[model samples]
Target: MDHIVIGTAGHVDHGKTTLIKVMTGIETDTTVEEKTRGLSINLGFAYMDLPSGKRAGIVDVPGHEKFIKNMMAGLSGIHLILLVIDAGEGVMPQTKEHIDILQMLGIKKYIIVLTKVNTVDEELVELVVEDIQEQLEGTLLEEAPIYKVDSLSGTGINELISKIDEESQKIERSNSLVSPRMHIDRVFSVKGFGTIVTGTLIEGTLHVNDELIIFPKELRTKIRNIQVHEKNVNEASAGMRVALNLANVHVNDLSRGDTLASSGSVQKTWMIDVKAALLPHAENPINLWDRLRLYIGTREVLCRAVPIGVERLEPGEEAFLQLRLEEEIAAKKGDKYILRSYSPMHVIGGGVILDTLPTKHRRFNEHTIETLKTREKGSTSELIADFMNRKEDLLTSMEETASYLGMPQTEVIEYMGEMVKKNQLIKVHQLYMSSLKYEKLKKDITAILDRYHKSFRLRTGITKEELRSRVASNVKSKDFDKLLQLLADEKVIKNHETISLSEFTVTYNKYQLKDKEDIEQKLKKAGFTPPSELELIGDNKERKELIDSLTGKTIVRLDSETVMFKDYYEEAVQKVINFIKQNGKMTLAEFRDMTGSSRKYSMIILECLDKNKITKRVENFRLLY
Candidate 1:
């Protein structure tokens, strides 16, 4: 865990800023516009040393309705919040709106403060406190302890600070294990420094000199320096307010919505899949293709909500949605977001991101909805299993799985070890094929071999490359090889130079047996020079197929224009061996005279011998291999 951040939220004139000024002695509202209006216009930052000896960072957000956008940005990474309310007026409109935003953002820890108690009598203060407590019911702050205070006199401020310190000590965040990411809420240039950006370190740790990239722009940069609470630091972790001096970028090129993260950690995308819910108090239901403004991690983009498995979403109902955006934003799975009406610009609903990148989904698709539901609520194991099962035909790599599931590669790898143990996944080298897919592939192999054998009974088997192209083309070559070996070991299939069913064998049918004898007799009669396959079969397609099946098995096709019976081919081989041994070598002309054949036939036989390595050709003569 790193530093704990605290934020202020309430309506205007709630004394939220004054309470902070009394505690930290640093006025957050420094701008002339803010001073002149007597209201915080932009986000302000201050830090205070807690009684527990830790410096807690504070964000003072503008309470005015017009600055709700800034308020939402300030609230983005804080672990706890101080929901201040004046004792004079309790539970105002903006107060309720802030509470709604806080709840929608899924913040859990809150400390309700009832400020300016001196302006009213004790009875009225008690009445306001009761009203505030009643409004807090069924909200996140229901159990939160409220403190009565007067920021002007500094009364009851010490107790509030002590409570904040107590709560901050209980915070536990994963700052060390994950990659660092920060959304830039402020971008400016100092006198000597280059572009500097400030935001809360949402996760992981950032170090000086660490190379990073600004997302949506994809401009690479290095961290020149790091600062926390006006003090230079070598490193900063999650939950702390951080300012980074970046190299190789200009202030004008940066903006408030840009994200700074470890390079390759995030990809900019317009479409995102999420489990979204419309607020119960929303003015109207959200229909498909209704353009809405999306806010996540201080970045806002316009998008259209295409509800999955439904045409429109009623208030308070949760469903899977594919948001099609007008522009791109970089986000990760599980990040919370808020959606505002395009024209009115009020918070209508919010959700947690399920997939940073996803293809456009069809409306009312059961498979899409089911898969998204698993992503929304399934465990790590369930998520992994569901993903592999859904993409059963693909060879999913660990890196690809981790990116889609929004998990660390090491974490996904660890879970994969367990998945293989449980027999849920079939791991082949660096890839994973689902156990279900393996079974289906095994079945397909047997079925394909069966069909091939029934169609051509006198052939050996299908080639390995042909089988793989039909069954596992998307699988890696090495992975498919290993799968063949596994299938062979399991007795599901036979793996050789060519793959086949374990029980498949070449056998001739009755008609093919008759054709085989007839063909052999004809070849024997022809002796040294047999008719070509085309001449023998003529137009008999079945006989032609039978002869083709006998190739490399029973009868040998000497050339495109010739064929030889197995015995005659062997007799020719012996004749070559004897002739070569007797005469050391024999020219094609001499072999023609010995076989009593023409030059063309003699050349074909000698060429076949040369190909079979029974004889080697030297110029125009043949010699024993």
Candidate 2:
């Protein structure tokens, strides 16, 4: 069944509650305070079965000036408005304010209702209708149908009901395939249910035992039961007014304006980019950095608006703005929001969210403004590409993209596959990066290696750790390794223990070459007993560089004061292995005698062989494994 919410908007004592009571046969106002004061202080709900066999949810919003915040909360999921105006008093102050709010909130469908018709004369009724028509000129409700009804006497009630049923049939149901999102408007502890939260499901579906996250606090809970229209249900979909009994959360932890959503489906952000317009009836021009109250979904947060490329926003002007919120909120692209002044608290302007998570932008940055404009009007693929491009240094996964875009993972996977096939995105392992970012990283890697080669002429290449730190520190280790391997496969770079450009090779000057040859010959002739540092170019920086280069190439070993040539080290290793294979094991003293060297040299060679895993030491004897 298609579920739609019709909300009441008008001034206090305009008979909104009475009209709903007579129409639905359910009294919305249940609180003692409301009955005693004869005014609503919070949102009250009821259900009306239309003549078309469709059920519509009724949200009766408080119309008093002090409770407008509560009214704003109830307006988030409304599909149509029942704007009430008392025929005796036409449009009052709160009535005009409510109209302004409805305009700002982007509610275009409504039915003008003139209540208390029996209390006014026929001429007064016609005059009031004329006054309402004039007030609605150039507004969303300009062409809305007008009906004068006396709820106390049941006059014109049947015609109003038929009209509402006709309008309800025209509204399309929300898609259930999108991730579920519900902004909590009421939270309480039921006698036997423990904790329950009620709201209108905006999208997707919620089932019993479904895990959900309360955002901004990220509290995890499961649905113990689901209820719609005071009856139990196995599952509920988008556009339904639902009450969920939560399993693991307490009533004290929940509050009005908190959002319940599918895990990882939405993100809480402190900054957003918007396309806003100041209302023509605004009393004051909105200056840059002006603090205002931002309302989206059921959330109301304090924020400062920084107008793009302008000093002050004159009344009736549209501009791009960056809103820095005082608290975090979970929102998505295309979500509507309303801004009210901080002091007098009247609706000033409203807009759609262009980017939910955005970096701080300069006031007059043309590129930023252009990008936001493109995102606002872009296609799904374009928006995904823009999201990837913004995360330049990090690889975005398909799951992450789904969450950021408020899309399902399966759909995101399909889009990503298409993007990869078109070469618009590069898939490295399971992570994704825009083609532009991949190309830029490739260039950066080459440049880093080129600089490293120039700075360290004696070194073979930079270590893998060093290269990653310089070029791809933000990338995951596995993803970074895969990227490097991919580069190596393309022959664009070489990778081993170190990474270097495929075209790069170590080169030496004439003097350095001569010194390297000298050192090699000396070590080669020394056999198993190599000379100490003091015996060969002691404390010389040039000779030290040569030693480091040789070690890097694995041509020599610099162990403390001992320097062993690679050839001799291999010889010693073979001897020990042969001795152990023949005798099953060899002792340190026996190895010393066999190599014809002192204990110091024998121990050093034995330790080197052990380090290389050529032999394992058991007690005082060494055994080959």
List CA RMSD, all candidates.
7.7, 5.5
Over 1-625, each residue of candidate 2 has an lDDT whose tens digit, in order, gives 4678899999999999999999999998899999999998999999989998888999999999999999999987788999999999999989988888898778878999999999989999999999999988988999999999999999989999999999988877675777889999999998988999999998888999999899889999999999999899999998899999998999999899999998767768999999998988799988888999999989899999898878888889998899999999988877889889999888888988888879998888889878987887877788888988886455888877876776767888899999999999889888898888888888999999889888877776788878888878888778889888978998989886578889887677999889888888898887777887567666567787577567646465646666777877777888888888888999999988887777888888888778767787899999985
The TM-scores of all predictions, comma-separated, are 0.74, 0.80
For this target, which candidate reaches the highest TM-score against the unseen true structure? 2
The model with the greatest lDDT is 2
Q: lDDT of each structure?
A: 0.85, 0.87
C-alpha positional error of residue 459 in candidate 1 after TM-score superposition, expressed in Å: 11
For candidate 1, the per-residue lDDT at 58 reads: 94
Query: Candidate 1, residues 80-155: lDDT per residue as tens digits?
Result: 9999999999889899889988988999999999999998999999999899989889888999999999999888
Per-candidate total of colliding backbone pairs: 0, 0
Model 1: residues with Cα > 4 Å off, grouped in runs: 389-414, 436-484, 491-625
Superposed Cα deviation of residue 437, candidate 1 (Å): 4.9
